[model samples]
Target: MENIAKVCSRLIFLSVICLFFAQAIIADKPDFKYSFGCLDKGDYTSNSTYKANLNHLLSTLTSNTEIDYGFYNSSYGRDPDKVYAIGLCRGDVKPDECRSCLYNTTNFLIQHCPNQKEAMRQDEYCILRYSFCNIFGIMDDDPVYTQHNVNDQSGNLDTYNQDLRTLLDGLRNQAAAGGSLRKLAEAKSTGINNKTQYTLVQCTPDLSQTDCSDCLLSAFGQIPLCCDGKIGAVIFTPSCNFRYEEHTFFGPVADVAPPSTNTSVADIAPPSINTSAAKGNDGNKSQTVIIVGSIIAFVVVVVLIIISCIYLRVRKPREKSESKLINWFIVKKV
Candidate 1:
């Protein structure tokens, strides 16, 4: 019995130590939120000029100090070897963080997709993509990616969905009406349980108002299919994305003054999407921490429960044997 108790105590102590280390690990290295899509379009030879142009273009794409608006579009080389790229940072991201996010994305694409002529990557804060053809000013919605919270809301889901839709619709309009510099909007609304539904919608600034609206609409339509009843969800497409959460998940947005009324939308220099960059926010990190912590905590609890059950089972038999011995002694004495 003593041995069993000691063993159980050791196990419980070890489990606690493991739980502490697990949480430390998670805090030290938060899981980065990102997705990669390596298109089957085509591949370039290692020594080909296309590869050289791609290397040169991506290497220097974020080095330009002049572009602080978080939208970058440029082409390198000419003809068949020309590589077009676009990088877009979240509107709320600072210029330096935006550049850093994009720089990391460029490295990611090159490392992960390697020889693919067309590839795209979306980080929590930014997106980076490249192609052989002119992807400029064109809205591509395919190859969509969606992520939702694992936990569901407790209140009436019908009311929650309706509130979410209303919030997204308003944000979509606000983002679409933005000028060529930026097309992004964020707002919050009260939902069931009085939980605040925070939402953000964004489109590449190069897109026309109509194009931006259409792209966001397509993304919104995907919510019912992908995230019904979930407390949080995000849908990503090539042209646009929308995210909603029960808690605040975005940073303070900078005030962007409206463009001059005389400036024609067509006259604005069209920003293109080829290779772009955005930085991650604290919301993604917190979400990752919560999810990881919950899983680790649950595992630890289960292990402790099992250990406790074994200890109780082992102690019960010893107690029964001692009781029998005491009764036998009393009878013999009598």
Candidate 2:
């Protein structure tokens, strides 16, 4: 009975660890709660054509040479049986990771919303959406989702909020202006009590600068509705997405160290001049000056020698000519 009890205790501990690990993994990735809208545009059996088109489109997205830039949009099949799809990977995600994320997203959509003419699925690293309607170049914010960390921010809430806004605003501008291929930006800032806040913003590359900006601004506007003073939060939409965390979430590149704004004058002040240390420094300086002077003097001496040689060489020719002239004069006198 004791042995059985010990075995059960170990099993319970393993189960607890597994549960924690699963939750951690989920926290790192974006959330996809459910499909936005589902409908049967055609017979459920005939929808195989639509599924084929979707498969082809998704495969093309990851396999395309341009997919590395992390944005792909295309339409497949004909109207009434056609599917328009868009895939966007996080700016910092690797090509392989982007592909994997997109693959999983497509599968998730198909499994959860089968035979639906329109569906959207979002994962941590990427977002994939398909519809019978045109989804390219147009900005859509419908089906917006918001999530926040359970922990409330510590310290002065006002300062934390301000810093968070500033950081996210800067990132939003950068991401909106990222150009035709990619519009994504990430940044970090020190908030209250020296806590660091990280932020990331991204939009589909097809949107114009103005459109991207507007899309992101709309998402930012929802912050108050979802994650006012939370330590972490994410706002996801079909056109744009942004997230913030007390801990770095996107990647190591976004984990920037906060500037030393709190540094005191004493921190950067020059060290006190101990007499002995000062004397040693002076000695080193003198040695450096002496060495520089010796080098200059040697260079001057070498230049002088070269000038003297050149001068003598020219003078020697003149002297030889003069001597020949004198000899010629003597010969004439003879």
TM-score, prediction 2? 0.63
lDDT of 1 at 133: 88
- Report the lDDT of model 1 for residue 25: 49
Q: What local distance difference test score does each model get?
A: 0.80, 0.69
- In model 1, the runs with Cα more than 4 Å from the true position are 1-32, 256-334
lDDT of 2 by residue, 66-163 (tens): 33456667777887767788888777765566778788887777677776777777776778888877777889887788878877888888887787
Which pairs, if any, clash in model 2? 30-124
**Tens-place lDDT digits, model 1, residues 193-268:** 8777778899998799999999999999998898898878878898898887766667766654434455332212
- Candidate 2 local lDDT, residue 233: 83
